[model samples]
Target: MRINADFTQRVAVHFDQTEWVASPAAGVERKMLDRIGDEVARATTIVRFAPGSAFAAHTHDGGEEYLVLDGVFQDETGDFPVGSYVRNPPTSSHTPSASQGATILVKLHQFAPNDRTTVRRSINGADYVPLFKDDHETVEMRSWPSGQVVPIDAHGGAEVFVIDGGFTEQGEEFARWDWLRLPPGTRTELRAGPDGARVWMKSGHLSGMV
Candidate 1:
């Protein structure tokens, strides 16, 4: 039942190294990440839908976030191709399906209450702004040329997952599905080699724990 289930510790694992398990629904499966409860557990995962498959309607009581990995994802709202980043905040609901099938990175029941930021950005559409700084911290997405300058402010933690790249952070190499977490007030940098880089990152959840 546990693949990469290390909630109380800092850990990392490559995606392909983990096995996928069946869900209650047909044509759907998941590579487990983290879980705290049984059926209603808060978790992160890589979910896949087989061709012409669909899932029943569901409510995101604790919220849901996903990045389309391959093919296309579908719902009553519309279709999402690869590179789509989606956020369905708390209390949001939707029915998801796909015709040609798809794979996605999904995070469930993990969002700040009332955090309403919802978006889908094409990773290639915008340029990566290195040395990006704000009053709170400096933020930057990955780029094609590789090596990146990372900045961290204070009172926060971060998780690193390579969506697509040969990424290395703090000298630790990470291939797809490789995951890592840094404690609060910790800082790290990343780089990608010949293939460029894409990642799924979440932060600002440290505070007094730092």
Candidate 2:
């Protein structure tokens, strides 16, 4: 089953408007943004766990990265509250559960072959840092101030997710939880709304794993 699986093109979706599809685990559901293959696939999703819900122990064969959007997500190692960003490298395993419930943005099977770093931290505590740097690829988080216009030049494609507040792009408004992906060589403009915004931005990584 493939959905927006093409890497050469662009894809965008507002998760707030997407339906929640149930996962194999009870009380857990997902809004898949892009996917390839079947049940075990390369995917990006917004996952929700109901109170007291838990997922069976599993290993990340390709890798897993996620950011908690709400409530608390827990595993054998520790509890991750909202705003927590975690990366479990290839071959890592864990039993994840939610005591009060949680919503998280997750990416699966998207790691580079030699990218084996394991990271876990709160977005609030970490300063903006470059995740990748190359002639065609770059990833970083930056501040978006209210009423400010920011230009974007997507040399090899780009993706953005609003982490707080809201913004407008090409006259379309995007609020918290909204995500956008643009094709290669596309030029775009972003204007922050009255509430301002904070965003996670990734450039390139659209045609190949970075």
Candidate 3:
């Protein structure tokens, strides 16, 4: 049940090269990025929901976090459109579905069991936004201008998901929907392509995760 489960090594996944695997739920599929267990596990994924599809109601014992990449995601809490970011803390319950369909980047069973904070929001028009920061992690949305070189300190580890345009790390290129993970103590720089790039990043959380 493990994908890129090694936290001590670097990993990169290009969206175009990955295949979608169906989940237990009908009409729902996922691209697993990393995993540490089966069924109920510590995992990161890209999920797509077909129109009129839904997942059964369930409680999150270890919390859940996600960002809507397209269409709309629905639940009793509300309907979230593209760019929506949400966190359902430990013990929260919901029945999620998509009316017309949707795609999201999700992380599951990755929070402190006692954590109860909840967050729901959307990405705005700003080029840079500090989404959230806590003792465990710092999440952000960043934009790079054409041909820019941006330095990043991955002292506590880091994960980045490309949302638009492209960038090169070391000598590897990352385009839209691509994902990259760097081990702790790594120092790196992203060199934006001709069209620049935009990304969602989470850092510090991987320090002691494995």
Give the Cα-based TM-score of candidate 2 against the true structure: 0.89
How badly does each model clash, as a count of residue pairs? Answer: 1, 0, 0
Per-residue lDDT tens digits of candidate 2, residues 92-199?
A: 899999999999988888777566677776767554745445554565666767898989888777888888888887778888888887877778898988988888
- Scored against the true structure, residue 105 in model 1 reaches a CA lDDT of 81
Compared with the true structure, the alpha-carbon lDDT of candidate 3 equals 0.92
Across 128-206, the per-residue lDDT of candidate 3 in tens digits comes to 8777788988989899999999898998999999988999999999999999999888899999988999899999988
- CA lDDT of each candidate? 0.69, 0.82, 0.92
Runs in model 3 deviating more than 4 A are: none
Q: Rank the candidates by lDDT, best first.
A: 3, 2, 1
Error of 2 at 187 (Å): 2.1
Candidate 2 RMSD to the correct structure: 2.4
| Pick by TM-score: 1 or 2, better one | 2
Candidate 2 regions exceeding 4 Å error are: 125-139
- Which should have the higher TM-score, number 1 or number 3? 3
User: What's the TM for model 1?
Assistant: 0.81
